[model samples]
Target: MELSPSAHVDTFCRDRLPPFDLWPQLHFDLPELRYPERLNCAAALLDDAVARWGADRPCLLTPTDSWTYGDLLRRANQVARVLTEDFAVRPGNRVLLRGPNNPWLVAAWFGVMKAGCVAVTTMPLLRAVELAQLCEISLPAVAVCDHRYLEELQVADAPDMRIVAYGGGAPDDLAARCAAKEATFQNVDTAADDVALIGFTSGTTGRPKATLHFHRDVLANADTFSRHVLKPRPDDVFTGTPPLAFTFGLGGLVVFPLHAGAASLLLEQATPDQLADHVADHGVTVLFTAPTAYRAIMAAGKADRLAKLRRCASAGEALPAQVWEDFRTATGLRIIDGIGATEMLHVFISAADDDIRPGSTGRPVPGYRARVVDEAGEPVPDGEPGLLAVTGPTGCRYLDDPRQETYVKEGWNITGDTYVRDADGYFWYVARSDDMIVSSGYNIAGPEVEKALVVHPHVEDCAVVGVPDERRGMIVKAYVVLKPGLTGGVTTVKELQDHVKRTIAPYKYPRAIEFVADLPRTSNGKLQRAELRSRAVGAAG
Candidate 1:
């Protein structure tokens, strides 16, 4: 597989891509997936949309501010100028973006793309140590952070990474620098296959891996899922709870909306109550969030505020069948449940409207194909559970990691989950085939949590597992063996929880902790996680 002539001046990312033979098969069967060899996605999504649609149309809508398509271009252009002039960033240089979801964060992303630099978006909830690990992997040359959350990033060890703060009145802030730059500039001519962004995802080992996505891959998702399934209208207003750092939110709030010339409302933080109010006040038609939030919104008795919503999407965790039936009964809207991975980018398997099955994650999107295969990759009989493998316009491509071989087997991306494909082609939910804990729409690794817990001085050993929760689909539970004569009680639990939170992202901290004499281990000295999961399930019940 010979490569195309790249537009990136710095070839670090292209040099690190897994050898051509190790790459997953990418099929561009859909007409929309066809793209020009020389293309920049930022220019395609933003510049082209403004030209096709009127410049005066609202593009990004906040609660108090509305940025027209033309306005967003000017801001994004300024940001691009600042990157090249102030920070000395070159094309293909990794620029780490840290911030909550907002108009500025969106602008920074576009600006990075326009300048031909790869954007590395990290979740705002990540603590200092987690951020440091990502920075070490990507080696970002510059970091753009929100002023409110600058402390943790400042403490993180980012090699040769200069920090620039946004959303501040300080004279040296990113906004202040942008004001001094020109309002217009020529965008970079990056190739369609050039790496545009790197999203970090958790592996079972607890260490994060950088997932590389090309400029065309960004639009491929919108073309396949958003075009065929979501079917967005130009007048639609989209809002969601997932942070922009996550690919789900990026597709829903930014890529999908911009691709369709629709308006998006960027909320930095919103509870179920506040989200309901925003929907009613702003006439939000397209909504995206997890099933837990949908349940919470109804429990808060804010169902009336969701009267304006027409389409809703649920992902991150599986949408329970009962919750789906209950929400549909109340709102007269059937939520679209999809299964997507960081590797695949966005919802490759989903159902919308009349095609949706309550208990099944619907058929593959128009462009993609899915299969349930045995250990040897042979197709399993219909209704029998096996590995869920997917391949289409987009698939996983890890940057310079040996795990690439594990993720991409043969020609398909083998998502580490077991599922059953019915005779009708509807894929039903079963269970995760790996040790990942999907709690509150976040994928947490048990090994990662165990590493954080075992570092505490009072802890002798620890095991983390996902336990069923009525509220959240699953909650991270930890069993710990204390050192010496400490009879662990509430005080011990609180101390250990705080320690784990400080060591890793707060969301990965074990919500439920129990004292144990020892963890179960097999004769080979490997931890028996299956036995513990059973014990945790019993204790949870």
Candidate 2:
């Protein structure tokens, strides 16, 4: 398919796209995977849902209100009208969206796509510094933000950008302006391969890299993982803890549900306790959350509240075997473990139901292909740990960045994760290629030790890292968060050490243990291992 001449106007994202030969091989082997050249994701996921299942079907639910498929379509149309008429948003203009997960926020996202504009959704909790960096990179012509987050957007360094605030009483508020606009809109005719969103990676290790996704990429995920792995039903109710800004949330909470004609329960802020409660109260059938959240829910003795769920998914970090086993024991549900990246849009490797293996991230999603390769990019033998390389319907396309070479090489997405494929083809995660620790003559994956420690009844949370040591060059160190009443004394440390020795290879046990009240984490609940390593080095010095 060729690019539509009328697809875009600004041309920044399109012009910056890495050359075609540099793109990872794209496959569309499945019959359902075929997409039309002229496509609009919002139209396919939202308006089409309304057409297929009536407008009155519930699509989005929250504590105080709900939006039917028809309601969301009307609101999205109004938002598109406001963008075109009030803000003068042109085709291909980048539109920055700032807000929590809400009906309005989802509507704004659809509005951007319907208008042929790029949606750069930023986390609601981000401060001016982060917002300024995004504004500098995407150069959005306008922003649709929640009233609560307007201060940060106003202070962000985007002099040419106009701001429209929603959920406020101000006369110029987006809702009020949208109210005066028509409830119907003609969506722009965009090419299937036209960039629709710029998803920025969560910069836990370094500066955030913006990943571009074509309109087809959005629907491709729903057709692949949501169809084959999740197999959600139209009556299913989905809920999760990830923010709308994260692609995981965007896929799990928005695209997957609407694609399947299911309803989603959106939450502005959800702790593990709150998430469990909502599952019980809303009769949520499908759950999407991180491993940390599952552990916290189990620790809080609230696992019983998730009895209503038929399926649970774990991602954003490696799902330790111990965590997976404990969750299944407590809830009788084997949490589906998947390995996905912001670069790839969603889970390219996952297993469902009887196919799930406790410690292994499953084979590639049907439309994708993956392999474990050595440093030279040659395929490694089974049982040998090496870099994970993947190619599929979706792959990394960084936005005008020099790091493009580092992400895409030789027609494959070189995910920085290290893995070893078993003789059966299940991929066992070793560690992040960069996070692998070499102590003495042994190579240790810190997550293996952390997993061994986390299963102990007294351990609430833990992180394992390599600490500098003159004699051994580097030694395993564990930073642990104990249960409230548990004392972080010598006895507890020895118990954890002994637990690791029994769980995996004895040589991988942490040589030193430090009890901390909490481990550093990103806003999305991913462990900041780099921060933990830095602190350990400082303490040693």
Q: Pick the candidate with the highest TM-score.
A: 2
Model 1, CA-based lDDT: 0.88
CA lDDT, every model vs. true structure: 0.88, 0.91
For model 2, what is the C-alpha lDDT against the true structure? 0.91
Candidate 1 runs further than 4 Å off: 202-204, 435-541
So what's the TM-score on candidate 1?
0.83
Model 1 is weakest, by summed lDDT over 10 consecutive residues, at 521-530
Over 8-47, each residue of candidate 1 has an lDDT whose tens digit, in order, gives 8989899999998998888999988899998899999999
Q: Considering only N, C-alpha and C atoms within 3 Å, which residue pairs clash in candidate 2? A: none
Question: Which ten residues in a row are the worst by lDDT in model 2?
Answer: 1-10
